[model samples]
Target: MQNNYFAAAPKYQEDSSNQQTNTEEQQIGKKAVFYYKMVAKTLGQYLSIYDGKTEYKMGVVMHQPAKPDHQGGFYVYDSLDQAIFADVPLKKDGLYFAPRTVIKCACWGDKIEYPNGKIAFEYLCPVQDMGMPKGYLATKAAMKEAYQLYSEKLKLKQGAGPKSLKKPTWKN
Candidate 1:
């Protein structure tokens, strides 16, 4: 096996306009600055699920349980699922549980042909097709519980988890 290493790189650019007399900056010609990035720890794998009714394409990050049993659940997010489907990268803050609002709504549009043959369209949520899932960001234990109910497989009393994550409920 090949050994690998990672070096943290500067994540933010220096502000040229700021002239604070910090001792480090005063003594050094230049310095590399690094910002901490918070990775979204699992409610297990991040995914999207279609609720049969109220919720549309609800984006969820859930942790499915392990072994010969049953039971599971999922925390709900009213944001970013559309953005994820639209190829938005996971933010530095990762998947946050922002309450559902118009800001997170994605839009769909159609080709409108004017009388003169000019075509136009706009992406706007029809409201009727909007996804407003219920539930809050679950506590870690809650996430585990949610997954238990949703996933078909049950967790063992004690053993390792499966090698790969289960697929999302809907295609990205």
Candidate 2:
């Protein structure tokens, strides 16, 4: 799939006088976007997220954090499909989630597969911020498994390309 640029429109460059400089936040912002894109190319491949019209982003609904990195109490998910998220006018709103059928990240807490072949993940990270792109307990398992597998394949001297030529996670 092509890159899903940020939720907002891109700000193009202008003349040198008005050109944009890379501030720390800007750099981190770019890295964050890249990290999200990496997610799309790797674990996203195993998911059937594209619903024919709108390509819903993988949104993580988390519980309160307490024991881990301490970034929490922001998103307390009580429902699989947020009422505000359903049938949204394609790509217009960014606060919504794909549904229980999508949003397959392990960081969502606990993954539950229904009998209808639709998968749902619960928001269970009450003590840790499972929202981080990496290093978090949840991301290490199913989240980045595809990337890890692709890396292992590359090490065997096999003519293997990336699960999309995936890049390493951003560092501060």
Candidate 3:
């Protein structure tokens, strides 16, 4: 005969405080930087983003629910060219249709709900395919302009001008 001292005891204490802290941390870490809307078509949805260096193609799953128990819906592609080249549809369950968009974020594994309150998707950081960082081209252009202005100012200080110097050799 053995004495069961902990048989009926709670297997583990429910730490509500820890759970609350975790939820808060998760919310703080899951902020979206930008979002692109992708309308689903009879075939599928596609999103192409060029961050000046790389092109990212984010595909959307169509005619399928995020979960087995989720309500069915349809998404029609807005572009005729895309509709013509979309993948084959899987299921035709719901008559209600709308465009599904993918939210882009810097953090991976972040989840966001759709405006319709029906679907949610996990955000994946596509940094590898993100190519150049955002605003890189614009910043580059600004820097180039500033350099040109500085060169012009230096030339002026050196008593060089259109009347005294030859036409600026550098092309705009």
Candidate 4:
């Protein structure tokens, strides 16, 4: 399969004179053109760089910040396939996805598979912000289990009203 991707090329003639140098340069140019054609054929329209805000589409380059902090830097939407394909570094603040985007997990460094069979690593921001990637919440079954746990806690609290009331409602 790998061999099918790269065909064996004919050996070049030895450059005995300066005119041979021109032939060598032509060969190099031909090889470059071939590579460009291959890239265009494989990536097609995805090869184009997206210009505008990340909100415009998934794969657009949002903005590159001048000063990078522990939780602030570059951001982009997942729709910008070229940015991800190029392996662009995420901002220290982590890559931001649109709210409607489905996050497979909240944990940083998790691998998320795209519909096209491409896999991307998740980078969560250490600090919470408006553009931070949102965590995935429980679905139907998990939500049901959470509801059951809440009910059980309520039952336990009813048995010890004054004692339970003394405890803080918010969790640490």
Tens-digit per-residue lDDT, 35-143, candidate 4: 0000111111211122212222122222223232313322233332322233323333323221222211111223344454333332222111122133432233444
Candidate 1 TM-score, C-alpha based: 0.19
TM-score of 3: 0.22
Q: Which wins on lDDT, candidate 2 or candidate 4?
A: 2
Candidate 3 on 1-172: residue-level lDDT in tens?
1112123112434385654233432453345233322222223422322111112233321122323233322222233333223332333442113222233323223243434332233432222122223332223335578789989988877768576564555678
List ranges where model 3 is wrong by over 4 Å: 1-139, 160-172
* Predictions in order: lDDT: 0.28, 0.31, 0.33, 0.29
| Weakest ten-residue segment in model 1 by summed lDDT | 1-10
Evaluated with TM-score, which candidate comes out highest? 3
Sort the predicted structures by lDDT, highest score first. Answer: 3, 2, 4, 1
For candidate 2, the per-residue lDDT at 168 reads: 48
Clashes of each: 16, 1, 1, 5
Q: Rank the candidates by TM-score, best first.
A: 3, 4, 1, 2
The lDDT of model 4 is: 0.29
Clashing pairs in 2: 162-165
**Candidate 1 ranges beyond 4 A from true positions:** 1-88, 92-95, 101-122, 125-153, 156-172
**Highest lDDT: which candidate?**
3
Candidate 1 per-residue lDDT over residues 7-125, each given as its tens digit: 12113334687644444323321332111111222333212222212222222111222212212222222234422222223334434332222222222123233342222222211
Positional deviation of residue 144's Cα in model 2 after best superposition, in angstroms: 25
TM-score of every candidate relative to the true structure: 0.19, 0.19, 0.22, 0.20
